[model samples]
Target: MNLMYLTFQEDAPLYLGVKNKIEGQISAFEKLGYQVTCSMWQDNRFCFFGADSFQRPLDPAKRLMKQMTSIANEYIGGHPFDVLYLRLDRVSSDMIQICKTARANHVKTIAVEIPNYPYLADYMRNVKYAKTLGTKVKTAAKVAVTAADDRLSGRKLKQYVDAVVLYGNKADSFFGVKAMNGDNGINIDRIEPIPHCADTSKDIAILGVAGTLWWQGYDRILQGMSTYKKSRSDGPALKFVLVGGDKTEMPEFRALVEKLGLSEDVTFCGFKKGKELSDIYKTVDVGASSLGCYRRGLTRCSSLKAREYCAAALPFLYAYDDAKLKEDTPFALRLPNDESPVNMDRVVEFVQHCRKDPSIAKEEREFAEKNYDWKTIMKQVLEFAGASMK
Candidate 1:
């Protein structure tokens, strides 16, 4: 099968989620003996467009549309693709054109990874096309419910797509998509939880926090930890380690820690990659997924960090109510609500429990390997893209 993958951004050195998803799928397709061509708006030269020297609201839509149309016309003109796999927002005129052209060429399949909500400008664009286009657009229900509030609008979007692949039972009804129950007949070969391995073993009970702490309730976790310190005095010294590239929000976080007299207990290790990040994960006794309340319907979808923590086999503490810490996940614990001051005690208790039972850490790694590994998810995605085992 010849597959063409699409995205909105230009390629950059940093590994973003959309890029990672595309790369994972491409790797799976190649492993299955498929020829994959990834065409994006920009190459490695420019990480992002419209950031420099461009006026406010610089629209790359026109350029992107031209580029996509040209690529489809040139590469897929005479030689039709077996599948035009799109991981794009619907609003892109380029995406709409690509789908229209792909269907016109009688391509066997056209699949999309739907956006969380259909109201975003990009999503609205895609929803508009899906309404008219007779092609099948695959999406996740966990995503659809984020932006869509109106029942009629959600149903209208679903009608255009052929199938909906839901992440969990809760998402199925919300988005009105067909439930594959995370087992959509797709083969997942490399699904395994990762184990946290530290480079040098340390005595302190290190708490590793990953992802955008500012965007996802990092303040709540920090505040909770501060409150927990006031109540407890005797235990292995607990240190907080935050990992991720974005550091714009670090100053405020640092200020809070200092105010709480936690300067010595906290460490910020800027952007890490590959084995470095994994090694850091190993040092920590517990992973923090301090997601706050699902304001405007945000936390309904599955979390990548939660999965990664499980993969590393590090017990994690999350803040959301609906967030499920899978039964197999040994070290994983969910807090009632990280937003309020009340949950601080619970956070401290959960951390203390993991410290006593180190075996739970081993269980978390085992569970991650079994379910949340990207290898397994990619395999399922490939089958959905119509790859045959033969």
Candidate 2:
């Protein structure tokens, strides 16, 4: 089988998660016995990779909309694949035409993955933070158009799109199409577990690694650290080692850290990768997964970081309804799903509880092997996606 995977994600260095995810998923598809091709838009050009990797620049003189239509007509109309997969960003006219062309070219199965469902609220939140009057006005206008386009496109997409690959699916169907329920699945081979020998007698460290900042909910962690500092002067000293989160919001977070007098307790390790990230992981007692997903209008999420934490055989804290992990799960400490600050006392206790169990790392590694691996998750997705289409 041959698969054409499509996404609008960029090849930017800052947010490597999306790039890494696409690469992992493509590998999983190959493992499932499909030859994969990745189609992406980056650096003002349309690029293709995997089976036959290439890049073609778009004409700068023409609007992107016009260029997208031409590209769809020229490429999708000429080439056909057994399956077409999309990491849908938005439901724009260009995307509609792309789907229509792919279907016309006799693509056997077409599935679009909506990573975040009901994402309009996230855009509205962005509108709130717009810096100037003119910027806010432009942003508000764009949001209005996008909302209308999405509503219209959702219905139109059903004609070409056979199924939706959804994460944290709230309904059996989305926009009048059946949903293949799914979550963020990791490539376990790529994520090696941290080989750490826990030392509970010394100070504790917590790690948060993410490219995007606002939604990760590090503020709650900072607040917890602040309260931890003030209330328990004798409490075991805590350190938060953060990687990435260099977006526009970093300055505000820095100010908050200073305002709360948590300079000594927190260390900002901005934008780390490869060995640098691995070295940081070895020092931390526990990992912090998405703590403020509620900010994105999500009560539950299959967070990628949560899976990464498990793959690393690391105990962690999270504040959302996970696809896996129960409230009683020993390796994980679940927090309330809201805007409240995390209680540092609870965090400290969770660390101690994890240290007491020698089998925690083994248990976590087992969990990742069984539940979070890409091959297992992708097989389930393929069962519903490709087979169901036939």
Winning model by TM-score: 2
**Candidate 1 lDDT by residue in tens digits, 89-153:** 43334444556666677666655655343225433344444543343243333236534433444
Q: List the residue pairs that clash in candidate 2.
A: 244-271
- List where candidate 2 sits over 4 angstroms from the true fold: 59-73, 388-390
Residue 12 C-alpha lDDT in model 2: 80
Model 1 TM-score on a 0 to 1 scale? 0.69
Estimate, for each residue in 150-268, the C-alpha lDDT of model 2 and write its tens digit.
88877788888877877753657778888866778788877778875566667889899888778889889999888888888776898898888866778998899999998887898
Candidates' RMSD to native: 9.2, 2.1
TM-score of each: 0.69, 0.94
lDDT scores of the candidates, listed in order: 0.52, 0.81
Scanning candidate 1 in windows of ten residues, the lowest lDDT window is 46-55
**Candidate 2, poorest ten consecutive residues by summed lDDT:** 381-390
